[model samples]
Target: MTTGRPPRSPSPSSSPDPFQVKRSSVARLPPSTIATSYPSSGHEASVYAGNRSITPTSTPSLSVSSSTSSDDTVLDESDDHDLHTALTSEQISSTIRNEFGYCANQNYRCVSQHNPEKPVAEDEIEEPPYYILFTTYLSYLLVIVFGHLRDLIGKRFAKSSFTHLMPYDGYAPLNSDFDSFYTRRLKQRIDDCFSQPIASVAGRTILVYDRYSEDFNRTQIYTGTTTRALNVASYNYLGFAQSHGGCADAVEESIKRYGVSTCGTRLEGGTCDLHRIAEALVARFVGTEDALISSMGFATNSTVIPALVSKGCLIISDEHNHASIRTGARQSGAHVRMFKHNDMRSLEVLLREVISQGQPKTHRSWRKILVIVEGLYSMEGTMVNLPKIIELKRKYKFYLFVDEAHSIGALGPHGRGVTDYFNISPSSIDVLMGTFTKSFGAAGGYIAGAKPLIDSLRMRGYCGPYAEGGAPCVLTQIIASMASIMGVSSDLVLPTSTSTPISESSVNEVLMPSVADERPLPSKVPASALPAWLSLPPLLSDGSEAYERIRRLAFNSRYLHAGLKKLGFIIYGHPFSPIVPLLIFNPGKMPMFARMMRKLKPTPVAVVVVAYPATPLVTSRVRFCLSASHTKEDIDVVLRACDELGDLMDLKHGRGERWPIEEIVTRSVELVHSI
Candidate 1:
């Protein structure tokens, strides 16, 4: 199975050879020498790092399916998985919103233990710019070290493998190595991409989304300001963040029982029955025999990573894997190698290297191997090629850990995720990790697989040792039961079942909006409705609570997608689901684009700005998430705005309201009142 660079996008392959790629994107990826060259003159830096992307030939194509008169019908259950996944991501992304940001702002007033050296705003004194930069840099560095420390500590413990960076830090100008440079570069690249806003003393904002929103509604999140000229972005898939019943319910429950702080680790007071139950239910839902719950999906990866690989072990990872996996792999004292995204050939090359090292007994020290991948690549909105990778796992004898954070309820014939989507036996995978936060519309992550494997990881994984509490328990149990229902209900839970990707006909039959098929449509169900299948009535009733509302949302999403696309926006996620990412070029254009969107519609969407660190510069886009709350009329307002913009941009049709607004104002007499 040749899975290296993504397959050429339908027609011609634009993928240059590896050497060429190395010269362009991957090469500049600071080698161990960045310590010698920390960009001191941030002021003199390139106004733009320049958005760039190196899409593999094997990456999935963004093929659009247009509707004709005859195609109106219920989309098949198979495509329902993505709608669920899309909605889930949308829900999470949306949660990063204003109220959350407001809460974060409020929390800032509290005293801080870590940074006791506080800078009071006496006489409105802003710290010197250089000092601020230094503080910010130190903060970034701390995050990098803390985030990747597991790798550093692992190497030291192994003696034969790991290299300690702390000791090297004091060496010369700095302990410059591939590891150091890599970690630094990761932070630098991300920070540089989202250059801190130029506001003099803007409020530090952190959107505090109602954590429970992941179930059925998306929470809209805003990181900076409503006024921050729009170049920044978020993951809002369904826009459920602003308001959603499931999200509200979950947040209410979490605050009520957990009361904000565990004060200690899960093993300490943190390990409530709530965390334990969630862990078990999540494990089963994701098709794993067992699971370990974590504070976050990322923490799950961070902890499980180094715990699994050791001394003579090796880790084969995808080039495009999330930073969490990379961090974990680094901590694992094993030799780490990377394959191109979805590229089986690159993985094979690394596998061969490991196996070819020596004879069996002699090579026993480095015998173990773990292959890790995200169920769905965040930027590409594509899935891991499971079948191709699984073959390698079977042949080479390597443990597989899939980060199904993005795809748990998004893919597979049954919404069982990538593994189930590909029809691989559940036990074939050594470990499975997912988040109840996403698909279930709540917050918390889990790791499931063989019970022994999970148990061992919990007791030994890096964070496991430090964790006091596991995950939220009550939520996970409910999630598990929902997953159980998904297995049986093709119309809502997972897809019916598929050996390959869902067929186009199935998609049209289930997702398309048409009166021809009054039956339940796949596209219209509130992704939150997936787990709510148990709660659904046997007969689909008109205007009922769960099912009735879900259908409306599905219809709204499609209507919104159609309206937005009509205005020349490249829609992502899908109308069937709720995520709609708008395609754009220059990062500079994003803010203006978002503002334009807001002004144009009666109830305009706050477009999320996306650029480099989060996605390739070339892939700069604005995500426009829709929801069940939206009305067909609301979609019309958006479309009319698009029509106006289309005309401004010289598009074929000018999108605008056919009617005009009437306004009245008086200026003469009121002008002098204040004076």
Candidate 2:
């Protein structure tokens, strides 16, 4: 954390040979590469991949393959001819443009590292036009009034419908009118906008099943039609949600070998060799002493937090934290307090008050205190002020817990999570929790910390004894994706005996690289710790593919964030954040915005629009989750769509310098770099 801004790298314009797309014939990456030995500190063995060193900063040149398939016709049919030509035949055949859009222009990629010399930008929430506010409130007022009226009439006149809301037999109704009001009235109106069914991989594009509600959304009937739409709705951050890729291939092998499940809880013989491998990799990835895996992301917090603190302990949490954090705090029986989201001053003030006041009515020393905050706020798109929080933690002496569910693999230069993004040591935070669902395209979560903390949770936390263990397929996906991010070392030896259980001590025995500034985590995965059967493609094994994914996601996130701001829309969150929330003030516009985007001609785009309950009523918004699988042209389509719809819907109300959609699309690379 140095003062002032770090000088910017030389501008793209300054290069004599600025990024140019050149037509070239390159050798396709062989299915299996020669294993290159990596210098290791321990016993070494032959690696699966070859010794060829690939440039991590630039996109590798891939050419036509010897074989082609009918599925490869999508490349020829794609509108992005330049990209189609640039991709190798193997890539073209394996990747459907609709599933994973390809982009070869290196200028559109940037590293997501923070410059200590530069001050973090203020993430102030912008107010919309006064008229927008008035209309939004009025809209909610009318809806509430009408909703009550409908309930009044329906309860008396529609006795059949009221049967469920009224007492039936000895048992009271499962849901009373008062309890079911919101879901029955307001949510039903926009039901079609949410829970959209899809038929394909939720990658760059999704096959949304077409359906309509004939009975006012009480029920939906399928039309047996599917529409392909550009996807900005899913949590596929680094674009690993693919059917064909190195990760997918590894997963298939895992499934064939281990079937689907471990069949029981960890303590009940559910744990497998894969779990040990994944936990070790996760610990290494996040630069922690050790890690514990959970079957569900939400459960990871809800179950583990209770084990950490209880009764007299105080949990200071961000007001905008996810539901799981709140659940965990409540279940922990800890005295919960809140600070305004990402407001360091408010947090410090609260910290002082709580410290002075002590536990409620006791006026005595508290047992322990934990400050819980999300690395990235899912709903608001704001990031926790980690650097400031770290500084405060030193003074306040409160244990810190960062929920990086949405930040890991999506933020930071090496996709190592928030600690990496802020250039802070992972050891600074007491606990680091993250999920594989968002960035890894897998289904579980992990809790990482000192070996003792994880070991304690394994015994005290409910998940380890009651919940089912991580599935073999899911663990394989995590291992493959994580290893790709942390390239596998060729000189590492594979464990000889499958019967030999891997313990924390054995994993910790792997050599820890010398700690260096800006290099907090190990650069490569200790292939010796991985299962011998798992094999990764050369690009994946070399780390170039994952590096590209990280940089591409960074570029997409910045371009979208900046593009919307320049379009005169009041967007929330850090510029580097992938979750971009565009305020649509009026609740009526939520469904309208979602529908308009989905119905865009030529190529429909799917977006997630959230309203009351998710956010403040007036801040009903459409959240765009950018992914690495998306091409520049895909983002151009989104920007253009937003520009057109924002005008028609009267949603652009920010007081900022504006740019036309054309400029935003044409100068996207420059715009991304500027941010």
Candidate 3:
């Protein structure tokens, strides 16, 4: 936990010598007078000016030294009172120096004047520089003046005068009116205050933004004009999104052998050795009999859902499920029923109601029922209660489908998926779907389950012949990444399951362990103790190093979460997860908060600001994605910047009360005009 730096010591040049005191400047009082005026209480001391008590801000120290004789010294109350009253400020400061070894300041002035060259203590410093004060005052004045002007303008103009100039109201612009309304109003508003969206790639310690300038020719693509910035937006969880190492080397070799594109679907001549290897690895990793790979992560769910479920079936889904799943469910022509997000009780209630009521219009039992959920909710960063869901599945006779897009290779002891995290057999899940774009550092997705189900999809699925298969290079990257994560080389043989296809009647028997008995497995192993074949030389090096990366990532996430919470930020999700959401409850301040974060000094932390449609109107937030590549120092810097910005903008929760959008927009527009 130590930062590897030594503790700072006080400089000798700043401290004054107490023993070298000037006795001539101090006033002496009569001992008889002091004896009559001092109190009898040894510990309790008080000073009085006439009838009123004049208490010192701090307790004064008393030193008694008798000049009569060294042997005749009196350390009594009377001597203590005489010493306290007779000593000047400088003498008292000298006494303090002698005791505490530091100069003490009182009443906005230094008591000890022994060292004139030394700088004044921070407590004695003046206000901020003149320029800061002037600008602050000017800004306040402008707001007041411009606010009145906006009010006047509104009163002078009728409703129709500015109707066309105003932007759309509510969460999003109406689709029919968007072109006319947004082009003339919203576009201008954004252009005035926001920069154009630019693209970038991950580099060492920063994101490299590609830009065009006058120095480069118009047709030249390699102008190389770039700006480096701190990356906080990307989801490169395992730190595998690099130009070098095992993943890159594999990609290079695959490209040289097979060229760039597959040019056909998996059913045609597009099935290469890399594709077969990747699919086998995925099937083994998830503990399933088979898996089907696709070129696109989104299309995997969109195309496969319809192939499995259709019109006579019922699909019960979580309300906050991803768009791809929702789209696929709609296309399947099944009766879709949505339950509240992560609310197990709500889901149970719906199941009970549906079972009692039967199919719509016809009081007959439903043909088939399927329950779908995600391993991790992307927006809220919360995990689904898999054990509870499995229990519900058994009781209700419903098939379960878990999308491990966020949880695979990021959760569990072996990075297998959520099933491993809960110590449940993968056969318990009817269908396990996941994307390689996140943890695997590749572009593709897979649907793993029993061999029969996969074979059905390969033959009847729409994506088999119409959609292009994954590129040879991308397949190689996926295979290498999976092997490295499992602590094995490409040639190493792994343990595989020989279980038959999972059927509705055999669900309970196949998943032998009861839901009540299931528990989580250890999520990490010591990096140094891993097998030699798993070591990827320069990149992963050893198992200990790999373990350290995951550990450091979790630690950094918790550190940042605690810091943001301390600053009054309403954070979402559990402390263990790396995805942190800094909630901005006031919808109007979401854009302002994002702009402030980008303007932070030293280096800008790139955060994705999610708003309405993605989240509820008032629950918008800035999402921070932590990675193994980030250091503790990077986390600390971000925390400090966010704290300062939150306070300055009064955006922190429970600090400033929420204001109406009209008031906020009015002020913003006024400020913009004034600027």
Top TM-score hit: 2
Clashes of each: 73, 9, 3
- Off-target runs (Cα >4 Å) in candidate 3 are 1-175, 178-200, 208-225, 263-269, 489-545, 654-675
Off by over 4 Å in 2: 1-95, 167-174, 264-270, 493-508, 511-519
Ranking by TM-score: 2, 3, 1
Across 263-340, the per-residue lDDT of candidate 1 in tens digits comes to: 311334335544444443454455444467676667888777777766566677888788888888777677787877
Model 1 ranges with Cα > 4 A deviation: 1-260, 263-270, 357-365, 412-414, 470-582, 624-675
TM-score for predicted model 3 compared with the true structure: 0.62
Instruction: Tell me how far the alpha carbon of residue 579 in candidate 3 is from the true structure, in angstroms, after superposition.
Output: 1.7
lDDT of 1: 0.43
Model 2 TM-score on a 0 to 1 scale: 0.85
lDDT of each: 0.43, 0.77, 0.55
Instruction: Give the local distance difference test score of model 3.
Output: 0.55
Each candidate structure's TM-score, on Cα atoms with residue i matched to residue i, is: 0.50, 0.85, 0.62
* Residue-level lDDT tens digits of model 3 in 525-622: 22222211222433242233344434444454555655565565667764445578877554445556765666566566666777556886446578
